[model samples]
Target: MANDEAAIKSYLAKYKHRDFTTREVMSLIQVYRSLTYRLEVFVFNNGTRKNLLNLEGTIPVTYKGAVYNIPVCIWLMDTHPQNVPLCFVKPTADMTIRVSKYVDSNGKVYLPYLHEWNPNGSNLMKLVQSMIAAFGELPPVYSKPRNEMPMPYPPTFPTTFPHPQYPSQPGPTFMPHVRPTAEMPTYPNFGLPYPHPGTANGSQFPTPANPLPYPTFNYGSSPEVAGGTITEEHIKVSLLSAVEDKLRRRLNEQSQQSQAELETLRRTAQELQEGKMRLEDILARLQKERSDLDKNITILQEKEKELQSAVERLGEQEGVDVDEAVVTTAPLYTQLMNSFAEEATLEDAIYYMGEALRKEVIDLDTFLKQVRTLARRQFTLRALMQKCRQKAQLAC
Candidate 1:
């Protein structure tokens, strides 16, 4: 029902701003119902990191006229939504098998849904649903018998109970030199009546004409593990080969993960470099601004010095006019006025008046009164000049 979608788009968008939590990702896969997930942080050989997720679940699939719960797994990449999650269909019983559709003996699924995964519309829920639908259509063929472990030899013992008819072996004896093989171990039905042990032999035993690879030592009346005897020297070479193959596949997967981590590190380094350049530019601007402020302050200080020098010169030129000094002596005042008419600077007058003032020839109160009277006289002169100018203009 979840399949046959027109487009793939982002679902659970509320979590887009941040990496999805394990719980959130599991829920999207329908964890409680038929899905499960685990989080893993991987550090690669190149000193890069990745937050990976392993997801597995069962889907209701119809396979070879039987409805079965087919197991599946998915590998979520670092940039999950922005990239496609690697999907796999697990073999039913672990025996190597492959199907024409999405199901394969190696648990590799080839499906359009996964191939066309779009970040805008694809989500865990939709992806799983699509997988379930594809798997339902002729999944990898496997038999229930394929699931049963081969019991080449199952150990058995005689019962010793209150019933005297049951016989017990004196001790635990075995054909230790006999080795088990791929052949199925024979087991006699306990319900069947057995012939008396005294005469049953000779027919069941082998002669010296045909030699077996193992020594002949009977554990019980019948040894079913092998045609002959079992030995400790034998090894399960097939099982070991299977294990080695699995290790190689795991190493391959690790290589892919390492490559992905390297890519992420490359992007991170580029961003850091860009940010550092931007900060350097900002720092340069700040330095320029600081230098500009220093120059402005230096110019203001130079202007202040020039203004002070001009004020000192003006004060020297305006030194102690006769009217501004106390009018202590008429001759001194006449001399001061004569000096002013001659355009004499105030510096010389201040020198001469200092001696007069110190000698008490001029009083402090009279000095201040003379300065005020001079200010009033300047104001009256300016007013008369302005009135004459107005009269001249009226005549014109």
Candidate 2:
């Protein structure tokens, strides 16, 4: 498990956001150990080349009670999660690409999930699960005829190892490169109904009963001696080879078991971490609200005490002066308010003078003269009021 994490971290060192992409790839491979990661030059539609990280492997899909490993490669862009990875089916020499609505002739995959990809919601693990489910419904590739042509030698390793020849072009074309040895995962049964064993045909061998054949050694007679006694060296070599093969198979199984257990622990730890963060956030918000509530309660208590003091003071006094109670904040405000009151009084005086003139209490010339003088005084007061309001920043 430590080695796996180290490898993942090393591969993700060149990514823009290493911390996030590392976690994503680690979790993905932990669950699907068959998948291997690599850095390769990805070619764009416009003939641009970029060295990018890609996870390549076969996901098992069950069809008609038999499970088939669907070879696939998912290419991650520099800004992964922000953009959907380019996915394609990678068929082997023994397999043929089966074109369908979901898969194009070039083996490029199209799905609703990829179309509606959300950075926060989508991930490699879910994408792989979706692929498995989709391929199960419609098998992507079928095995070619055995008699048409055969490989010179049977593969010693499982086909889960990614083929080295991934065409650099935009299409999913296979070219030739030397294949590397990779350990086969003793896969846990996953998917709908059928589980992938990560072996050839998902079959198990019993204790290496028929180990790989070794050439018979004859030292005393013709090389074609049929009934010749085998030497101790040959016997020892045969026994060692058989034991080594058995130990290798055991180690592979144990390694996969350990990997599965480690993956489960990692998932649990992640869940606990998330829960801790949620609890911390909730606690912080609650603390802030509590502080605010305490402050409001203190203010209300102070207000109650002030109201009680006022009630007592009013009870003690026979009368309260409303004018004294209402105080202006500034001397300028006091002057402005006094000016408004005088202007209103002058308007009332002018109205009364006009009334007296209408009742013939004074002559027209005297009435006109008194009214003009009063009007001039009132206009002066109105101008002063307008200036005061402007100075006080109040609307006229």
Candidate achieving the largest TM-score: 2
Query: What TM-score goes with each of the models?
Result: 0.33, 0.40
What lDDT score belongs to each candidate, Candidate 1 first? Answer: 0.47, 0.64
Model 2: per-residue Cα lDDT over 1-396, one tens digit each: 778777766776777767788888889877766677877676553455667787877676655545555667888777777767778776555554555446543466766677667888898888888887888776766544445452233434322222222212122333222235431112111221221333543323222232211112232332432343435654554456446544544675577679879999999999999999999999999999999999999999999999999999879987768778767999888888777788899889889988999999988998889889988988888898889889999999
lDDT of 1 by residue, 1-396 (tens): 133011112222233423453334645644324455544443433344554565655555543333445555565655567656656554322222333435432345556776677666777777776876776564543322333553332355222101100011121111211225544222212232222112231112223343321122222343333433333322333244346545544674576578779989999999999999999999999999999999999999999999999999988885677556656345544444444443333344545556777799998786556546655655554455455445445321
Q: At residue 13, what lDDT does model 1 achieve?
A: 26
List ranges where model 1 is wrong by over 4 Å.
Answer: 1-32, 41-49, 99-106, 140-396
- Model 1: what TM-score? 0.33
Pairs that collide in candidate 2 are: none
**Best candidate per lDDT, number?**
2
